[model samples]
Target: MHAIKIRLSQEELEQLENLAGAGYSLEQIAMYLDVPKNDFIAEFYDLDSFVNYHYKRGLLMVDAAAGLALAANAAGGNITAHQQLEKIRMAQFVEREKKRIIYGQETP
Candidate 1:
């Protein structure tokens, strides 16, 4: 069956971002948006498209919020938060190094 493409309105775009930020899976997001899974996938199939861009931006938003909270807790002497924050930093560094090796030094 051919999937019908649906364009999201501004309000739906906002909902999509919020849902993604809340860690909803793609299938769940589709259901919440009242869209068929296949149609939703069809609309967002391009990773470089606006749909994916908003999705990733949403994920980054949550990551940033969590990191901020962790930093605050670590500053207040939470040992667990400190350790987790350090682990995240180390992982990010490792990922950057890997990217640099694979895609040259200019990778962001």
Candidate 2:
């Protein structure tokens, strides 16, 4: 048996993107769109892919704003801002190291 195909209109897609960016879960977005959660999942690639795309987009926006604030604070000699930036840099370095180790790359 062939699976039923569900097509989203352009407006619906835009709405989905907006809702997802607002941190709505897949189930919530599905309900807002008036589509069954299961059907929406089946129609789309998967919940993770759809949710992650929008969530990451939202995070990027937030990160940009935070970065601007941090820059201003650092320029004004805010020690806490400097510390927070260092912590974030260290965490990013650790994550990169982890990825390298997982991929069997020799670490210097």
Alpha-carbon RMSD to native, per candidate: 3.6, 5.2
* Local distance difference test, each candidate: 0.84, 0.70
Q: In terms of TM-score, how similar is model 1 to the real structure?
A: 0.77
Local accuracy of candidate 1 as per-residue lDDT tens digits, 8-93: 78888888889999999889998998988877876677765666777888888899999999999999999999999999999989
TM, every model: 0.77, 0.56
User: Distance (Å) between predicted and true CA of 29, model 1?
Assistant: 1.0
**Residue 38 miss distance in model 1 (angstroms):** 2.1
**lDDT score, candidate 1:** 0.84
Model 2 residue 42 lDDT score: 62
Clashes of 1: 0
